[model samples]
Target: MYYAILAYHEEAAVESWTKEEDAALMTELLEINDRLVHEKSLGPAARLGSTQRAVTLRGKGAGMITDGPFAETKEQLLGFYVVDFPTLEAAVEAARDLRRVNPTAVYEIRPISLYVPGTPLTARDED
Candidate 1:
């Protein structure tokens, strides 16, 4: 099964990190990425630009265009990892490993619903 690991963190807290602290965090993240790659479970992953730069679109057609995210929250969506794991337990373990790098970070692990080219859209079990 495929899981989407969504990362969330406080922008203020992240911005307050020292250069060395940020570098060390990046190093740890890179190591995690390497481990995931070696396991062949890693898929698409990326760090998103700040939410302040985001544009939110709501309603039908060109109605209600707004600045920033859909909702205002203390923790912002920072990044995500799409991973393929055999079981929910395995995916949870992977998420736990990722959390070790930054205890302050929050991860939302959700199963990915695949779209069959000629079939109807479906949803996987939510985690």
Candidate 2:
């Protein structure tokens, strides 16, 4: 099954981390990621840009565009990981692995109902 692991953390706390501190944390996290990659369980993962750079659209159609996220919460959705695991337990374990390195963040796991594979685009396609 495919799972989406949503990473949430206090933006301020993360922003306060020094470059070296952040790099060290990522190094630890990547160690686990490397294991997942070897197992072929890892999929798409991403780190989101700061909320200050985000925008929200409310209502329908064009909607009402506004700066920042939709809600003002202590924790912001910082990043996400898409992974494939045989069972929920396995997926949770993977999230646990991630949490071990970054204990402060919250991991939200949900089974993906549908997945559409995109066609690989070449550099020439951008032009």
Candidate 3:
């Protein structure tokens, strides 16, 4: 099976939802989660805290560490899901369904890779 990373990016900054709307949205998102569970492809899904709480690391000579995201960008990592599917088509289909449920968010479909024991392929080799 293949793994897909479903990500989102908001076009503009917005306030948190109201209590009533938040409840309704939760119910709808739960339904989507149910669908994934039914398909037997939902591995792990969760919403992350704001990027302000993030601590990013980068490698330098002698192992140096950095703080915060590598660089500030308009897009932030709101949340993610690790889904296992039989094919890229199936993964993209799931992403489409998710987009339908939350039309305001932009969905980025990325394929996850596995590392083999010997003769591992580098990113350039895969390309």
Across 1-127, the per-residue lDDT of candidate 1 in tens digits comes to 8888999999889988999999999899989989999999898889988777898888987778688886567899999999889997888888898899999999999888755489977665654
Model 2 residue 12 lDDT score: 94
* Per-candidate count of clashing residue pairs (backbone under 3 Å): 0, 0, 0
What are the candidates' C-alpha RMSDs?
Answer: 2.8, 7.3, 4.5
Positional deviation of residue 82's Cα in model 2 after best superposition, in angstroms = 0.2
- Point out the higher-scoring one by TM-score: 1 or 3: 1
Residue 60 C-alpha lDDT in model 2: 88
lDDT of 3 at 87: 77
Between the candidate structures 1 and 2, which one is better when assessed by TM-score? 2
Ranking by TM-score: 2, 1, 3
Put down candidate 3 lDDT per residue, 61-80, tens digits, no spaces: 66655555654656666777
In model 1, residue pairs whose N, Cα or C atoms come closer than 3 Å (at least 3 residues apart or on different chains), thus clashing, are none
Candidate 1 matches the true fold with a TM-score of 0.86
Error (Å) of candidate 3 at residue 64 is 4.8
Give, for candidate 2, the lowest lDDT window spanning 10 residues.
Answer: 118-127
What stretches of model 2 exceed 4 Å from their correct place?
Answer: 118-127
